[model samples]
Target: MQTNNSVLVTQQIKTWLEQVVIGLNLCPFAKRPYKQKQVKIAISTASDDDTLLQDLLQQFKLLENTPIETTETSVLVVTNHLQDFFDYNDFLNLADALIEQYNWQGVFQIASFHPHYQFAGTTEQDPENLTNKAPYPILHILRESSLDKAVESHPDVDGIPEQNIAKMNQLTKEQITELFGYLKD
Candidate 1:
């Protein structure tokens, strides 16, 4: 039932999750859900903003209606389009609007990832951007209740970003390229 491209993308995402994310301890919270098979990766074929928004809403609804134990979160991988970081960033507003419209604001939150995820005001080459950068554009949808629980249980939740940035900064460009070779053009 799966296309070749779909299978490949899913496997690539799994590799990134296991190797880059968990291997480097970039996201301490990711390993558990991934290991438990609760993280769903949905590939979207929408080639433009209009269609992508529809695809986003559908994923949002799927996560909302599904049982939490079976599905904790979803990553909407926009492989057909939104390769441009700014375009991907701008589309998030529409995603939030849809969430608000469906009254799912508190139920879910969106985190962004892309190949070139530069935070505002930061230089493009800043290693800190690696925190959010992925092999493709991804909108990570998470349940707020679970997130809140995780945050409440953590001793130093506030230090996570600083720690991630510091960790990423230690890697030189060659190291990053070697680790994330698939992302290169």
Candidate 2:
């Protein structure tokens, strides 16, 4: 059963995906799966890393068992933990290890998003960090095959990061606040 808080959180994520991600074309490939309703949003209320990993495993299993036509991808929203960017970044190692442990390296991959997702050598205030910032910590589970297909079809797949950074740089303060208001509180 979904609680009111979970419902609200899911709605916020969906809004961000639609308005910031798709609206600004941060991810050129997101629109189709989103429009097709093949994206699964799973909320995790774990307050500790161990519990969070269990939640993550559940999502991984879900993706592993489900067919691609039914669910193309999943976003596991970690609501109660990893609020610190550094901790979240470090936790990615464990996430990657889990994939290797299961020998799912080429079968599945995880893309991370967080409320404060600063890249290496970049300060917290850098505009480019907004490219991966989200309302909450998210582990996006993607099918490796699907990604290969997307990459093969995209005309300039390697330029996506540069394009996203350029878009982030163009955002005004007001626009950033409007699009990412959840981060304010």
Clashes of each: 0, 0
By summed lDDT, which 10 consecutive residues of candidate 1 come out lowest?
176-185
Candidate maximizing TM-score: 2
Q: After superposing candidate 1 on the true structure, give the runs of residues whose Cα lies further than 4 Å from its correct spot.
A: none
Candidate 1 positional error at 150, Å: 0.7
Please give the lDDT score at residue 61 for candidate 1. 86
Model 2: colliding residue pairs: none
Candidate 2, superposed: residue stretches over 4 Å from native: none
Q: How close is candidate 2 to the true structure, as a TM-score?
A: 0.98
lDDT for model 2 comes to 0.93
